[model samples]
Target chain A: MVVDHFEARLVKLARKGDQGAFAELVDLYKDKIFHLAYRMLSNRHEAEDIVQETFLRVYKSFHRYDDKQKFSTWIYRIATNLCIDRLRKRKPSYYLDAEMNDQEGMDGYTLIPGDERTPESEYLLSETQEMIHQAIEGLPAKYKSVIILRYLQDLSLQEIGDVLDMPVTTVKTRVHRGREFLRKKLENKVF
Target chain B: MDCKQASSLMHDYLDEDLTHGQAVELKSHLKDCSACNERFKELEQTEMVLFAAIKPRSITASDELVDRIMSQIPNQRKQQAWIGWIRKHPALTAAAMFLFVMLFSAISLWESDDQLVVKTADLDQVIINGNTVTVPSGSTIAGNLTVENGKAEIYGDVQGNLTVIDGSYYQASTAHIAGEIKSIDQALDWIWYRITDMFTEVAYK
Candidate 1:
């Protein structure tokens, strides 16, 4: 990714307690981080929480930032870690609770009302999106991140490696495996 | 390439990470193998769906999120500003610190030392009696003259500068000085004189 030239100046100003600069930085990254978190967690509310917590942690740990790393890499690493942590916490009892809710005809999506649509084509489009989301949500956390970062965020394999602190070769392998997993899960679904 | 290798290349090709040579090889393999060709099509379809479904959403955080984050940041203490400044300009701080130490040491040395000293390359031309030094009339000194903790009475010519520290100089009407005469009566003045003298020596060299 092309690093923003003004980003370093903003980071310097923010480090010195320029709240306006910090707010500009937040504005620059808010949507990207939100979209990454939303795709990773597949829940709007939890994704929003991840976004808030990621920036909060970034603020608290500004002193620890090493300038050698790109600010985007640093922030994405924080947001990715937060999403992984939330996913891990959702594993034991929360996982069971979610499954139970699904059995009780209360899948998480039902809580939010669907958008009004008069055209059958729009309904089909939403269904395709729903199918794609389900296929991705079924992936293991490891594969899910690589797939979302690769296709959804369009990060280069090397950039993803830096954000995830993995070797480029390892990132390539995960991306391949993740793609294969998606292909298998999405084989029969009509797009 | 075999089917397994072809399968991996297809993924690389979809990601646009394949080299031209590898792409050519994968293309030939897919042409020759129906199974791999079918599999490649499926992978392509999956990627297309992924891009079509997700990229359009462009989910954004609500406006209150930025405000909430700003609210959580504790106010930066006023006293830390200097610390931040020092952190930002370490080289400047170090230079200032070095100058301060040099000034302090010069003042302490001045306070600790009280002795009568006279410096002149042509000391033979100067007459010393007790704490008083005299350059008699019509005798010329070739170089700079420095006197400390004493009195200097000049009735002759000086070819270079004359400096008096913690002392005084009296020049007669006939005395001719080709250079500046400086008197240092305080520690601060002494320090300034030493700094300028050092710089002058460096500049001359």
Candidate 2:
């Protein structure tokens, strides 16, 4: 995304290890990066850590980063890979209560963001958001990354495929499967 | 677009990635088939819900995170290149390696003698974890006190229950208990404590 007029210049200076330029880049993208990490990890503290680590890696690897692709996409790939690595390290099984909470929220949560929506509708939409987030968390890494990038991050399927280094067809298949999985999990609930 | 084809293209249709011809076929099929139409509506609702739910929400990082990252950046260390260049020279490499080892050992030795003593007054809850837990005089526990694999020396009053797991509980002469003190050493008690701990953590945390 073209966040500001100085984005290109900032990237150039940040590549030279200019702390001020790097901080400016951080200020522009921190929220967006934090949003992606939070959705991917489902924990605020871990997401914050991922944001810091992602930028630190960006600075460290600036020499290797190409100026051809969008900086946002490159940083996102880093954050997503870090998230996938962490998720892989976790035991496939978690506390049963947490599983139960996920199941319960699937039917319970629903909240839409806009103020134009009714209070109850907004509450329901928010609950749905939580349910979707938890369900996405339960997905395998590949499916989780594709789903979050496409739906939450609002990246195109082609963009997601590029970020994940997968073919467009594979991305579509994963999206379909992920949606089907969510549909089954959320059966009987109004989306 | 039969039900079979429609089902396969449902996601693409919702994503708006279907070709114009394919979308027309799917729309035509939906118009004629009530079941397919209902299913399509449901799928469409899911797309809408997903779009509405997963927006770019903001999470403010900790105030110190930027500063912490900045300080830890390799660029911040002006001597890094100097050190790297020195490592390339065998003579200076030996000297640097010797200095690093010496400093590391000295720091380790100094750290080994440092005790992690946290007073109960300064903590919301005291979890005595080492060989012994000393509840200093005039300090009262505001929450549950747990001593694990250690002895608890309670010199002041406890507002919450005191639990010693695989440990001994010693009540000093001046100690006053507002809550029960229990020392659990048996396997059954240990299992029970673990189960309760899990439930409490799940419920409270």
**Candidate number achieving the greatest lDDT relative to the actual structure:** 1
Provide the lDDT at B41 for model 1: 90
The RMSD of every model to the true structure, in order and in angstroms, is 11.8, 26.4
TM-score of the second chain, each candidate in turn, equals 0.51, 0.37
Place model 1 in a CAPRI quality band: acceptable
Model 2 alpha-carbon miss at residue B24, Å: 1.4
Summing lDDT over every window of 10 consecutive residues in candidate 2 chain A, give the lowest-scoring window.
A103-112
- The sequence of per-residue lDDT tens digits that candidate 2 reaches over residues B1-205 is 5798887788887667889888888888888999888877777776777777767543355567677777777654465557657867988788878988976875565445334433334364343556778777787778667666668888887887888766677898988777777787765576567678799979998
Least lDDT summed over 10 consecutive residues: which range in candidate 1 chain A? A115-124
User: What C-alpha lDDT values do all the predictions have?
Assistant: 0.81, 0.72
Give per-model TM-scores. 0.61, 0.61
Q: Name model 2 segments beyond 4 Å from true.
A: A1-5, A95-97, A102-125, B56-59, B74-205
Per-chain TM-score of chain A in candidate 2 equals 0.80
Candidate 2 lDDT over A140-166, as tens digits, reads 778878888988789998888778878
